[model samples]
Target: MLETVRRQRRAAALPYPQMTLAVPVAIEGAALHSGKTVRMTLRPADADHGIVFRRIDLEGGRDVTDIRVRHDRVVETTMSTVVGNAAGARVGTIEHLMAALSGLRVDNVLIEIDGDEVPVLDGSAEVFVDRIEATGLTALDAPRRAIRILKPVVVEDGAKRAALLPGDGFSLAFEIDFDNPVIGRQAIEADLYDPCFADDILRARTFGFLKDQEALRAAGLGQGASLENAIVIDGENILNEDGLRYEDEFVRHKLLDAVGDLSLSGLPLLGRYEGVRSGHAMNNRVLCALMADETAWEVVDFVEASRPAYAAEREMLAISAD
Candidate 1:
């Protein structure tokens, strides 16, 4: 059983050619922050195009900006991740869609949005994941590139922290703590490359405290936030009609955000990420720190034969966990 598990993991860890969607997929919903109806289309792009977002609503639809997903393009991380280009065109709240693309291992895509923010879509990546899967994936001739950590990189802001360490496959471990008894502390760890991501992480919805709703709205944020799109906590009780998706869903959502934020590196990462009370800002900071230190990480092409060694490393980590 152990060997079978190892083999499955090894297969998943092995990298292959780059991939894009087989066909274009479109989704329409209300932008979380703007609360305006928006239409987005995920279009297939050639290899090496990377993931770029184009704002089609600007300048009578004549303005097309390729906002690369990178730390430098990040203009805001207050309540959500926002990326912009030199032209000042920006896209906000892209974490969930980015997370879906990362989870599906898509290498190149053109995200065309008709508004400033991507739709919240149930406050989770579930809908995005389903749509992408329905479109299917198409393999390109070019090899996939991955950012492999060579040394530990850490970033912190007060008590919040996020880090990326040398590891074999993409894995994530997160810890979160809130003063409310409803969510005092929670932690979760998983190999993101595994199939578990779709089931375990994609459905985890973003959450917030009910007490802060008014303050958030006053700040011109969370204008569309409600029980329909987010997990709202009020003191010791969950205000959602369906309650929790998972007991520790708050932390899992954190993991999902980390995946999306880190994907800004423009390549899939081969590292283990650890976060404690970290949010979008900390996640982006950690990525910036890793990129700033050239010696800390290296981009490499995934080779199939090398996967077993990586699998062995994961085995050791599992043993230590036991």
Candidate 2:
């Protein structure tokens, strides 16, 4: 990603630095999909290990799954993204945690989950970001790597559309429309170069129309979602007892979700992304298209940096290329 190119380390000026933590951080809460309580510990991983999920609740059950988004494992895209291996073991609605990791610029992690889904804590990545930020960031001996899409790939479902285009840095443009007066049409475009961008949009909660509640519950879904964690809307009104975080929070929240979903790439993506009335399905389609095109991507290592401490941190990264 372009962010690494500007990294202030001549000795550590490498593109991707294997990153780790000075200490481990623990987070406890409820998962959005499985609707169960969870307490997870986040430990530093070595370079190339990327991100992984470990299920400790299963005495001998095979619940662990890698967070890396791949073409073969995306199982659902209706309300959330569900990823798993051939065995059908998976994690659901991983956007919030993904947003938190990407927001804090964390490239590698080992997530130990006690339940089927990540806690829907506050319906935002802020909590996760705060907890992880407290642990701080350390550099690795290597530089950071990026996913640079070499060609334009687009996916569409009727009026909905999502696409990835070549770009120098990571960027996103999202637009949503709801005929309801409370959240009519809203849009946002961001170049994720500033660290504060995530802080600005990452905490907005997910929202839904009141009319859809019954159908959701009938299908045994959204049992855990409520005003406390999401912005509920009824007809033309916003249903949360509390007010909106921002007048245009609907769009901001969408961007937040996109940030987390895009993180499936394992490496930070280096390109421009656009979504028009897009959701989990469309987003996954874009990634699938990229993977389907072999010429669209390549793997490369970092070559520069001026920071010795970061260089030392890079050495600490514990991932393998394969």
Best by lDDT: 1
Candidate 2, residues 1-322, lDDT tens digits: the string is: 3233334433243344667654688988876655678888888888677777776765554433444444356788778877776555677878878877876667778888777677888888878877876667667666678777789999989889889887655778999987789988999877665545766788788888778888887887788888877888987778787879989888888888888888887777777889998888888888888878989876555333213543554454422211
Q: For candidate 1, what is the TM-score? A: 0.90
lDDT of each: 0.86, 0.74
Model 1 Cα lDDT, one tens digit per residue, 205-257 = 99999899998889888899989899999989999999999988899999999
Badly placed stretches (over 4 Å) of model 1 are: 1-15, 60-64, 303-322
Question: What TM-score does candidate 2 get on C-alpha atoms?
Answer: 0.86
How far residue 20's Cα lies from its native spot in candidate 1, in Å, is: 0.2
Which residue runs of candidate 2 sit more than 4 Å off their true CA positions?
1-7, 10-16, 61-71, 301-322
Clashes of 2: 31
* Error of model 1, residue 291, in angstroms: 0.5
